[model samples]
Target: MDTKRIFRDFNHCKFLVFTCLLPAELFVSLYLDSVINWSLWLVLLPIWTLKVLVIAGALVGTIVWCHKPFRRNEADGFTDFKAMLITVGIQVLLLLFELLLCNKIESNSPISWILVFTPMYLVSTLSIGACIWGYKNARSTELESLISLNTLLFVFVSLKLHNVIHWNWSVIFIPLWIIMCLPTIVVLHHLWTLAFLRSNFHGVDKQSLVLDTIMWIAIDVPLLTFEILLASRLDQQNDISWVNIFIPLHISLLGLIWSTFGRKGGNTWWFGLREDFCTIFLRICPFMRLYGNVECKEREGGDGSEIMMMPVVTQVVCKSPSKCEPVVAVTHIATPD
Candidate 1:
């Protein structure tokens, strides 16, 4: 397979890289906000330096992973222009707001207010514009992805602006955290489904609509549970009751539903037991690797008969017009079946 050609598929690679980096970025931000006291930066220069270094490393890693080696033609023209404009506009607003919050200039002054408020206005406008673009160009998934990123960024900035004005940590942080998690969860779901479908269906197996339904539930139930749990925990200092009692019960119920209906094979279920099994295996295989062995294999006969064999394994493969890309194919042979 041509690595360059594979990389040229910017939509797939970009989304994957974005999904991976977002979690890391959120964690780093959390550390910076919670652990590092901004006032002590002068006294604890070394600690501040180390924190900056860590953040820099994460930023570099994200860039390396997500950066396209060769720019796609689709990425050029108006898309590039629009993305650049939005990014630049965001930065400008960020700077202005930071200045206002720090009280570098008197708030009573018209200039200060304008500086503080300009970014908020721009972000809102850009968000609406991006949404319109997304609606108009629904066919271009790449464009849609770009719009999604921009919209999310706008939300982040808007939340930040709210924080600056209200000066309430709980109100500000909780909403911001939820906003960040939204994109993270969506991206994860897409990647998970992409992987699951590629491995199970080979190409688009429209006939196996049942399998697709199972795949969705299998991926979503656990993911939604984990997300709710995580968000609840983050907001625990504000309200522990939800995280401690209701959330856990909700997760248990979701798990039970998934285990019962998710595994049952039929058009009633949307996808089959085989896919549910694959989804469950995919979810747990990483932790399982710490203990023992698992394997999955597909054997093809000349007569178009195919056999999928497993020894506790999970795999996802993407098929293109010219080539089939193995996204995740982990195998272990303890006693070959």
Candidate 2:
């Protein structure tokens, strides 16, 4: 067999299979331990250790595969290593936290903070890092699309975990997470769109934006519905009432509306629509008065730009024409002009 063919086979067979199976296995172990009340270390530890070993083996395999005397420049040493390390590190951290710590605690342990918090932190960090690198290095629409989807998954997963562990049940956080997701999501959308648009113009035969739009709506609508349903079901334990349903309902409706109308022409309708509605609703909805004036702005430079630009201020009032309240801003300066 040829060396290149051998490398390709190893990547497909060993690395890919290990990467996919490790997560599935870990999640299965977690479900058994948490929801099913199975033994933790006895059933999961060996598998978890194997996952680590497989990942290590994959990393080593990838290195070996890249090593060729004649194909020195073919290897992206630091970049490939960094990417693999970050990804593997996050998976390992998640396994340790969800499998080891989450199971061990009869009650939430403050000292076990490392296991609880580290996964979210590391996953978020790696995701943001990968997104930044992908934005810079990813040369194809398919790769960029995959990265974008992964980034959204990361955000959703991280936020979901945070809410499950730390956040209280409130409609407030639903909008808050959506707000948090806006900028990164927008950037991802823009990249995916631009890549395809450019490909189309260049006659590279990319996927259709219309089809992409439809596919996005199709996937998002069902997923959002499921999320709302899950949220509603979870909320039943706490506040099983119409008011409790409002959050998830609003979330689902807004998501559908946004996907249909807001995301029309591949531009976000959230900020503008929110502003218009808030402007109108503020007159009728007395609670809207509590929100004060929110001004979204974007910052230049740093990894902060990669995830979403940080909200400079949360709550403040607009005193005058020159004065504006601080809000979460999605700046697209880093995006190609």
Candidate 3:
């Protein structure tokens, strides 16, 4: 009966599903590339499928918005609409870059790596500006660090690919190494805070602290391992199997998906779709109807001549405590006939 709770759960569920699918697809693509000589497009089929679904959902949402009978009470509907458009545009841009990169890699095209990565450069530039705006507005700038480091990594990659830099692949990956070290700093801070709280005789949420620490370790350790293995493999410093190299990545992705399950609500572009899916699912699920607390049932009237569906309340008490005794009560909602 709590619509807000239902919507919140739906958003969390959507995040869980996306986290599972997207990373799984990427890992599978990596695995396939190592095993088979499949075409890049074919290997990327799952990603394309997800993109198609997203674009289709956007179109459907746009159509429904244009023809809807009533306007939403809050302004979020319009904001979500704009967000959907932006998401689609970004998806298209990333897809363009992927296609170009794939073509260059597959056919040994003359297209420069810088040209292939232009879309990512543009995205990173926009992300920098967004991060600046966010910092000005007192929003989190943690993501800005990652974005800047990634952009630097991209530059290092392009230079290495173009033979403009003869540095070792591990050296080229210094930015990513720094990125990974950030979590180490955060974990150390958390430990320090915990120790301070304990030393001061302050109440500590040990359960939450333990869970947070475990989650950080689960995600970061595997992620760091994956990066190390990848860098070593790229540099031919190690002859580890590709499957083994990707195992840590798979573990990290699983940790990400697990974290999403424990997360609560936040604004996501699929908010409307999640709500619609939740509603339809509840309607079709018989067990949900059977177990739900709220429902309308037919009751015979006093004369036994009419049946009506009404909202019923039980265990009512008089507002004035002295006027009446507390007793079981049934209040019927009247209906116009």
Candidate 4:
């Protein structure tokens, strides 16, 4: 009903920019790739095809951002459902077309291309599926907050699942399937944050959902990385050692991350750290800030006389036992005047 807010929330004109890019990219890929035929379309056309996937992702992202429910913070969760379903349906058709093309090419085509492109294809496809499951019938996405910040990162890495499969390790699919499924954990994490924010969370749910997320991610990263790396080595015809140096090194680094972020009665757990020089190494360094250190700050405007200071994620050090302050809440983000 509020068209202005909808456009504003979706960021007027931005969607057009991305949507416009698709045609331009298509023109270039089609015309420049020496015509559009089954050869280029059905087979993996290398970077050109990858670029198309990127474009598809961008287009999907654009649609997601502009979905009316997302713009209005509606909880129906059905906002982009139909669109995403159609997108996925189309991908399925393409997969069928690809299979036909495969048979046309060779009996035992190297399966690497199929493995490589499928996950991203799903990512660019299934992203708009609305992640709903009978929660109050309908809910706004932001309210539901049913997505983890780590979803994209984890999904991207899990794309390498095909690598493990290509290694001829049939048993690896079991773990591979689990790692790929971790995005659902991210969705649950988002939903968990929403419950915590809305005061809807109880002890049972917290331990069940939050603890589950922490455990799954804690296990997934190391396992997937080791598998992918081992597979890559095998692919490269290099000898793999039982004592994989990378596994321990990665574990140590992530262990440090968990210690800092997981226990999180700290600033880093709230506002993330920026990759600044020397300041991280020297804690006392003056004016050190993470990138979003001072983001979405609240302010009194219209009078145009306020002197707003640079927003920084200041440390909330609890110097006294009895004076513990609460972590910053999402409600703290300022609304427009």
Number of the predicted model whose lDDT against the real structure is largest: 3
Worst ten in a row by lDDT for model 3: 312-321
lDDT of 4 by residue, 1-337 (tens): 1221221123211223234333433443444344655443333444334345534654554565454333334332234343334343444544554554445455545555445345444544343343342234342332112222234433444344434323333333444545456555675665667466544535554544654466455645565666666555545545654345245335533433443322212111101121111223224422222321233444655586553332434343212234434334243444334
> What are the runs in model 4 whose C-alpha is more than 4 Å off?
1-84, 87-94, 97-206, 234-337
Q: How many Å off is the CA of 211 in candidate 1? A: 9.8
Stretches > 4 Å off in candidate 3: 1-34, 69-75, 132-149, 193-204, 265-337
Spell out the clash pairs found in candidate 3: none
The digit string of per-residue lDDT tens for model 1 on 1-337 reads 1222122222322232334333333333444445433432233333334334434434443343345333223323235334433444444454455445445332344454445555555655665565676457432233233434454444544455445454333444444455446545755666566566654565564433544445545545555554455455555544443323333334433433433332222110111111223234334444433222223445554575544443442233122334433444344333334
lDDT of 2: 0.44
Spell out the clash pairs found in candidate 4.
74-140, 75-138, 75-139, 75-140, 76-139, 274-290, 294-311
**Of the candidates numbered 2 and 4, which has the greater lDDT value?**
2
Model 4, C-alpha of 228: deviation from truth (Å):
3.0
lDDT for each candidate structure: 0.40, 0.44, 0.63, 0.40
What's each prediction's TM-score? 0.34, 0.41, 0.70, 0.23
How displaced is residue 135 in candidate 4, in Å? 16
Weakest ten-residue segment in model 2 by summed lDDT: 266-275
Each candidate's number of clashing pairs is 5, 1, 0, 7
Score residue 185 of candidate 4 by CA lDDT: 68
Model 2 C-alpha lDDT per residue in residues 63-161, reported as the tens digit of each score = 554553332233353444444455566557666566646454544555444445556555665655666775686522222234334544445444565
Tell me which of candidates 2 and 3 scores higher on TM-score: 3
